[model samples]
Structures are given as structure tokens and as C-alpha cells.
Target: MSERLPPNTKIRGTGFNISDFWSWGFSDVLTNSLRGVFAEFLVGSTLDVLQQPRIEWDAYDLMYKDKKIEVKSAAYIQSWHEGQYSKISFGIEAKRAYNYATRSYTPEPVRNADLYVFCLLYEKDANLIDVLNTEQWHFYIVKTNVLNTLFPQQKRISLSTLEKITQPVSFTEIKETIDQAIYQ
Candidate 1:
């Protein structure tokens, strides 16, 4: 298990601290990679799983209660500015699971998570975008069974295609919606 470090924890033989590294690396939360991790963190927070350390190579992003969750994120505004906002899509590909202990992979591809949470940063204006603001985002929750039945072979899905299936919920409703998806 990874130990949580204090912000003031110093690097040996260096003046920098953990906070310094975090500030330099994760200050831009809108970037694709960081944003995805941030979305996972947001969902984990909503599910009351923030106490758990994130496992980078885990087949699913989080395990809340008995439900395994996979989170995907997309945004209109990116860290780098272009003439137009980028198109939004989320990956839903099934892949073989990697075992850390055995140093082996599953024989076949599969959807390891029980459900998926799709997070969209809908704020179009770069200047008005605040990733920290929950109101600026929309989340769509769907059971793996339903998703697999709808688009069995689909590797990725567009926002429009996704909208036809599941309605989005606010940040505040995420946990409720997830419970509904899982329990109902």
C-alpha cells in the first residue's frame, strides 16, 4: 500500500517538497490524462472511497461497497487552446486484466467493472471553466450489463450516442444514481 505523504514532506538532498511536485505537475487539471484521474477522484469522493489509494493498473478505477466502477472523462475546454473546442468521446474498450502478483494477463478481453461513470466537463468557455466546480460537470451512470447489451462491440462512444441511452445526473446525484443503477 502507498503511504499518504504530507504536503511538507521533503525530498532527500533537494529543497522541493511533495506540494511542489503536485503544484508543478497537477496544477493544470483540464489536461486529458490528469482530467481523467481527477474525474475518477471526484467519483471516488462522491462514493466515499477517497480514503482508498488509487491503483494505477487496476482493471477498474474504484471499488465502492461491492460495486466495481470504471470512470471515463471528456472535456470541451483543454489546457491548450485551439480555434475550436475538441470533440467529446469516452473509451469503453474491454481489455485483458493484468495481475500484479503473478505478472500475467487474463486470457481474454472483458469488462471488469460492474458499472461505468461517464464524466463530461460541459463548460465550453475556457475562461469560465472551473474543474473544481461540481456544477460545471455532468455525469452519466450505466450498468455494465445495459451498456454491453446496447453496444456490444463498440470501443468508444460519442456524447450524442451516449445521450440516447442514459440521462445525465448532477454531481450531487451521482451516488444516488449509482445506487439506483446497481441496486435497481
Candidate 2:
């Protein structure tokens, strides 16, 4: 004879709740999705630009006027604990040709977008992951052409190195900063 347990019932003496473990695993995916969305929203709202909500995996996150903008975000406090400030790096991949038949990507040295926006959540205290706190978040904008020429073979750029080439700007100053980078 066998006994069936209820959906919410915990097994004999394991001492741990299975549902709690599942929630822990799912939190990573949720956190990442939220982070990306928050970054896009912050940029769009500050610049007074509308976001393209339906676009996915299309290279860029938002479209403003005649420019294509790619947004990348990083946080100091992630799933694990860190002893020091987290190093932030945003991917700058060249647009590649995809072969549908073979499902392979060919590397091309072409820039996909006009500009890149790097967002950082630098909270030394791991407890502060709240997107509502504007002071914890920082934004840096750089031109795609400048990044390609400076980084060349590198696909990622660190915040420190990026600061050498360009300074971090507030959300409200994004448009003016980008315009300066372009016209200068």
C-alpha cells in the first residue's frame, strides 16, 4: 500500500522546505529581468524618450530620435556575497550574420548601434538592491565608434577604463552628454 501526500505537505524529516529552495533558484532569473527593465526605464524616463517594449534580442534596448541605444546594467550585490566593490563590464559585441540552417554565428567587426549606456548599481551594503534609490545607480554614455576604436578586440569594457575615456553622467544629462560625444 502507498500513501499520497498533499501538494503543500513536506516530506517526513528533511527539515528543509522544497518550496523555499525553488524560490531561491528562481530569484536569480527574476532579479536579472528586473534589473534590465529598471535600467531601460530609468534611461527612457530621464531622457523623456519612449521605449520599444516589443523588441527582444534585437541588439539595442531603446530607440531615441535617429539613434539606437544599447543599455547594460551591473550590480555590486548579486546572488553571492562580495568582499569588495563589484567590477562592472558591459558587452560590446559586433553584429554577426546568423546562419539559420547551421545555427551558427559569424564574427564581424561592425558596430551595431550608435551609442551605449552603462548602468551601475554600486551599493557596498549588499542589502540595498532597490531600484527606487537613484543615488545608488550611476549612468555612463559612450559612442559605439569610440568604443570600437579604443577597445578593438575586447568585447567588454570596465567602468574604470570607461571613466578614463568618458565621465559618468546623470540620467537627466544623457541626451546632452551623447550629443557632445557625437559632435566632438
Best by TM-score: 1
Q: Residue-wise lDDT of candidate 2 within 1-184, one digit each (tens)?
A: 1343333566458765656654555445216566776787788777677533424555566777678788888877665555665567777777774544676765665656788888887766766566567777888888888888898778788877988988777766777887776677
**Best lDDT goes to which candidate?**
1
List CA RMSD, all candidates: 1.0, 9.5
Over 4 Å off in model 2, which ranges?
1-30, 79-85, 97-109
TM-score, every prediction: 0.96, 0.70
Tens-digit per-residue lDDT, 1-184, candidate 1: 7967889999888999989999998999989999999999999998998775788889999998788999999998898968588898899998999988898999999888999999999999877999999999999998899778988888998999899989999999999999888878
Q: With candidate 2 superimposed using the best TM-score fit, by how many Å does residue 128's alpha carbon deviate from the native? A: 3.5
lDDT of 1: 0.91
Runs with alpha carbons beyond 4 Å of true place in candidate 1: none
